[model samples]
Target: MGTQAPSDYSSSAPSKMDEQPEKQAKIDEKLQRQKEIDDWLPITSSRNAKWWYSAFHNVTAMVGAGVLSLPFAMSNLGWGPGIVILILSWVITLFTLWQMVEMHEIVPGKRFDRYHELGQHAFGEKLGLWIVVPQQLICEVGVDIVYMVTGGKSLQKVHKIVRKDEKDSIKLSYFIMIFASAHFVLAHLPNFNSISGVSLAAAVMSLSYSTIAWTASVHKGVQADVDYGYLAHSTSGTVFNFFSALGDVAFAYAGHNVVLEIQATIPSTPGNPSKKPMWRGVVMAYIVVALCYFPVALIGYYTFGNKVEDNILISLEKPEWLIIMANMFVVVHVIGSYQLYAMPVFDMIETVLVKKLNFRPTTTLRFISRNLYVAFTMFVGITFPFFGGLLGFFGGFAFSPTTYFLPCIMWLAIKKPRKFSLSWIVNWICITLGLMLMILSPIGGLRSIIIQAKNYKFYN
Candidate 1:
């Protein structure tokens, strides 16, 4: 039988059916590409994280054990100077952070993923890296050490409360070791984006403990029958103490090192990648930070006056249950926060080890090196448990540059604000303040360390 010619309708129908799957496949492929782009790590991708996540990360970085010292800082500067300095620090830090975000756009088709990169962009690679990287490492590692010491102390406090008779049961070093081991596991998580859940939890824990501390302060203040003085006890003898307090306040607000990294997480919108979301998130986070910080500082100092301990919690004579719970929250928050801060250090070290030293970027290698780094920090914490002095040194030496000096310099270098113009003058003023703080605060901090060393024993 002769084959009948296929009808046009029949031919077209099969053709359309074939094309339907092909078209659908193309659509599926396109969707897959979009998903890859969207699901990519924020460290590498421009836009992956939502602004709220960024805010949570920022808060996690900003709110730490440092907040506990603000009252002691207030005691140093007194209420008037303390409040003024606190506001100024926040304003300057926020402005510098904005400058950092603004500089990201100055060079088209390039993004500054890390603070050191911005430093290298502004200055030569060697000089910029040297200026920023060491300070950043110091600040971050110092913070982790602080977390270890503070967390161990807090856990010890809780232990003493819960086990009253067993107050001297275990050494602080044991608690620090336990904390470090916990951090070792979490620190293995690949990057910042991977820790969003932990960051959010850390932020919540920060708020929880801070609220408890603040409430306790108010209650103590109201119930006490002591004279409240808004100023320091004596101005002349406590000059160094005053600066030490200033260093503490500066330290409390010294999350500027990670600001750009945190901002990197904010997802960019289509056709408009300006930093509106980042700015909004920053403003919101800082507002929450101020609310958390101010009341605690004011009320704690008001309650204890010159008698306030470096950590306000140390001074509180609250119910053992409440204090233990608050300290436990602190330990929990710091556990997550240690990972948050340490991740950047891990990225830096791993990049160098893999790229420069040719170490394979395998999971085992990462786990090993990262845990070793944690071990080193643990050793430091155990060897020197001077929490207050460490805070001072890190805040003054590391934070002064990472938080203040380098940002101004990078802004000046990248933006090249006109000579004697408002931007120039403002940045110069900031630079001057940074230099002054850098020079003086460290000296005071060193003095504090010397004084503290007299009574401090290893693993005490």
Candidate 2:
């Protein structure tokens, strides 16, 4: 009987070959739907921003509390190396950022809006996600956590100046809570364009306070006994400090993390590619970056030298009104920065909840998720407000790849420049530098954190 006839399996059930196509079609349909859902995300929802939006958004993203630390970083590096690192970082990071902008719309009529999406394109879907998401989340969330500490400290600085006797009356933990509270409201603003006003204000405030930081240092003049020597007493400590300082420089130029997202906001077309206006905005932002960084770094170190506080504002104690105002500006600027970074993470979380976890998309979900994120960052900030150490650690460990080398790698992979070509050589050089930064800097940063943690108490 077995030899008599072959079973008509196609009649009983579709053959495996047929099932394959059916499964593939279902997968394609699901992907198409998910793409539609992605459009509603905060990063992609509103694409009506002008070029200036990119300018301030990049400014708000790039210039943060990191600027205040530059002079301190300079103290770690000294005159020659500090100036060289800062300049190279400016040039190299700007190059990497430009590569990111150009890559945003590399494929025809398609935009890699999120950093991970671009990663997916370059490294294959699964590999790209693996490569980029951790780095990106680390960078974004790290910045948010740092901002929490920054905002709280800045607010406390204002309070200290305003109410000299009652400075310790309000706890820093409470101030951080207060800083996180604003995000609970502003996080609901629904997309990048919606928060443009806040970003604009933040951009202005970043410049304002940065001006105050360096100018105040200038007004104070160089310290009477300023020592341009390394802060750490030991050789190993100084080496580590140099590594950590490199991380600080890397962290300072970290606007690249959100460059693709910012570019996503600008409207793109064949003739009028988003890159043109995006580049214009980026150029302007970097100019602001140079203005903010160079003086604060050079003069701040010259003024206070190794004694300069991690936050320059903390060192500027006199001229009560100006210090108070600058600290307030930092508070406002951090408010904008926190939201700018958190927006991308919100999109990711909402995506996972709605798409992966089968949760319905609702305003309540947005509210709850955003609040939890703000709270988590606030807690971390209040617990370990080791600002410089955190920057150095996360800056090199996470930001180095994304900000410094990741873009170049993607460019080399996708563009496939000829060997020894200018593009090829440049990208390789960046990759080498970035890898060194990643490997060496975090060691220093972690050492610093451990040293700081020994003296730190939670919620103090």
Top candidate (lDDT): 2
In the range 1-460, model 2's lDDT, one tens digit per residue, is 6753456654678778989999999999999877767676788888888899999999999999899889888988889999999998999999999999999999999999999999999999999999999999999999999999999988877877777786357888999988888988898988999999999999999999999988898899888988988978989889999999888888888888788888889998899999999999999999999999998899889899899987888899878889999999999999999899988899899889888897866788888998898889988999998989999999899999999899999999999999999999999999999999999989988988999999787877
Position 274, candidate 2: lDDT: 94
Q: What is the Å distance of residue 17 in model 1 from its true position?
A: 45
lDDT against the true structure, per candidate, is 0.79, 0.90
Candidate with top TM-score is 2
Model 2 stretches astray by more than 4 angstroms: 1-36, 166-168
- Would you list the clashing residue pairs of candidate 2? none
Candidate 2, residue 283: lDDT: 94
Per-prediction backbone clash count: 0, 0
After TM-score superposition, the amount by which residue 304's alpha carbon in candidate 1 deviates from its true location, in angstroms, is: 0.6
Residue 282 CA displacement from its true place in model 2, Å: 0.6
